[model samples]
Target chain A: MYKIKVHVYLKENILDPQGKAVTNALHQLGFNEVQTVRVGKYFQLFTDNVDDIESRIKSMCQKLLVNEVIEDVDFTIENAA
Target chain B: MYKIKVHVYLKENILDPQGKAVTNALHQLGFNEVQTVRVGKYFQLFTDNVDDIESRIKSMCQKLLVNEVIEDVDFTIENAA
Candidate 1:
């Protein structure tokens, strides 16, 4: 099987409230060093097909994995077995 | 500021319902190639102090960012300018 790892993050122009909350929490917890915080998504996927995985993953990201309007997705593929 | 990127994922032994749901959806959508799927968290953190960012991040992961029992956390630090 092939292992596909996807990372999805909000675009620079978008606002992330969750990230801001975390940053505020850190500051409240005495970690004043923390400035900005943004949260994202990570996925680990196993696939039977190794051939054309890049294209397949691209399609997956475009279709179901990411919201193309607000988030950007990137991925890496590796041999699982 | 320093940009810190954190990736948190469940250990192999743990079950991920969200990943399973996504996998089932993909199969229903005709992507039967998918075998197993696991969902995780991603974070982008900005910090003013770079001198001790690594240790600070390690502490953040251990204390507030990661559960440490069921999830594993990994991170990278970069100059955010």
Candidate 2:
């Protein structure tokens, strides 16, 4: 078995209204000084052991996980068995 | 300043075409036995010190970071100053 961790986010140049909204919400909730915020996603998966997980993961990001138009994705594979 | 890592991925049970495409690409590249693959994204940001990064981060995930339609997001804040 293998454990994979995938992380996702918007491209830096892109405007993250979602991120900004959250940052504003935070200010409202009490935490100030938060200049900005960026948000993304994550996943943990168990897979049958495979070699070359990194490249494959990256390929996956490019092909499906990310919008490429606005978002980006990166993944790490760990705890292979 | 605070550093945040945001990860994003498709929600479990949601079909991950990107992940599948990547896994297939991996097999083409030589690594086999890879039954499953999932992909996501990551974002790192340096922010002016904020009082509560975790909850705020999580709130961001719920409100904006994730699609809620097909994806999910989680964030970790570290190296705060």
Candidate 3:
């Protein structure tokens, strides 16, 4: 099987209110060194070996896993036992 | 500055309905090779250099970034321009 780890996050220009809130909370908690926080989604997928796994995974991301207009996605695929 | 990437996921034995839903959706989309899908949270934090950054980051995870009861967190810290 192949193990795919995907990370989807907001575009750099996009506002991330959740991340901002977390930053503020961290500051209030005495972690003043924290400058910024960006939140995103992570996914782990286990799939049977297939032809052109990279393209297939990318298609999956485009079709169902990510909103391309606002989010950017990157993934790493590795062999799994 | 230091860049920290944090990943938080539910405990192995915990039920992940959201992941299950995504798996079903993928199957519906004809991606039958997909065997399992696990979803988690990802966070990127930018922080000023500090003493014992590793320990401090761990503290942050324990105190605010993770529930620790049902979720597990792991992070990587690196220097950033």
Candidate 4:
């Protein structure tokens, strides 16, 4: 089996309200050193070994895992223990 | 400055409905090789240099970034460009 870890985050230009709220909350909680926060999604996928796994994973991201318009995604594939 | 990346995921015993839904959707999309999916949260934090940054981050995670009851979190810190 192969393990795939995917990270999907908002585009640089996109405003992340959730992240902003977290930063503000942290500041109020006395973590004033925190300058900014960007929140995103992470996914771990387990799959059987297949030919062209990279393309398959990319297609999965493009089709359902990521929103291309407002977000960007990257992933790493590794052997599963 | 420092950049911290935090990953928060449901505990192993926890049921992840969203991830299950994604897995089902992928199967419907013909990716039957997919065995399982687990979804989680990712955070990018920018902070000023500070002593004991790792402990500070751990405190933040315990206090606000994560719910220790059902979630587990880990983070890595690095110098910011």
Maximum-DockQ candidate: 3
Q: What CAPRI grade goes to candidate 2?
A: acceptable
User: How accurate locally, in lDDT, is each candidate?
Assistant: 0.89, 0.69, 0.92, 0.92
Better of 1 and 3 by lDDT: 3
Give the lDDT of residue A13 in candidate 3. Answer: 99
Model 3 chain B: worst 10 consecutive residues (lDDT sum): B47-56
Cα lDDT for residue B42, candidate 3: 97
* Model 3: CA > 4 A from native: none
Q: State residue A63's C-alpha deviation in candidate 3, in Å.
A: 0.7
- The pairs that clash in candidate 4 are none
Error of 2 at A80 (Å): 6.5
Give the worst 10-residue stretch by lDDT in candidate 2 chain B.
B26-35
lDDT of 4 at A62: 90
Better of 1 and 4 by TM-score: 4
Candidate 3: residue pairs that collide: none
Error of 3 at A66 (Å): 0.8
- The i-RMS of every model, in angstroms, reads 1.2, 4.3, 0.9, 0.9
Given the true complex, what DockQ would model 1 score? 0.80
Best by TM-score: 3
lDDT of 4 by residue, A1-81 (tens): 888989999998999999999999999999989999999999999987667998999999899999999999989889987
Worst 10 residues of 2 chain A by lDDT: A41-50
Summarize candidate 2's per-residue lDDT along A13-42 as a digit string, tens digits.
999887787777767765565677776765
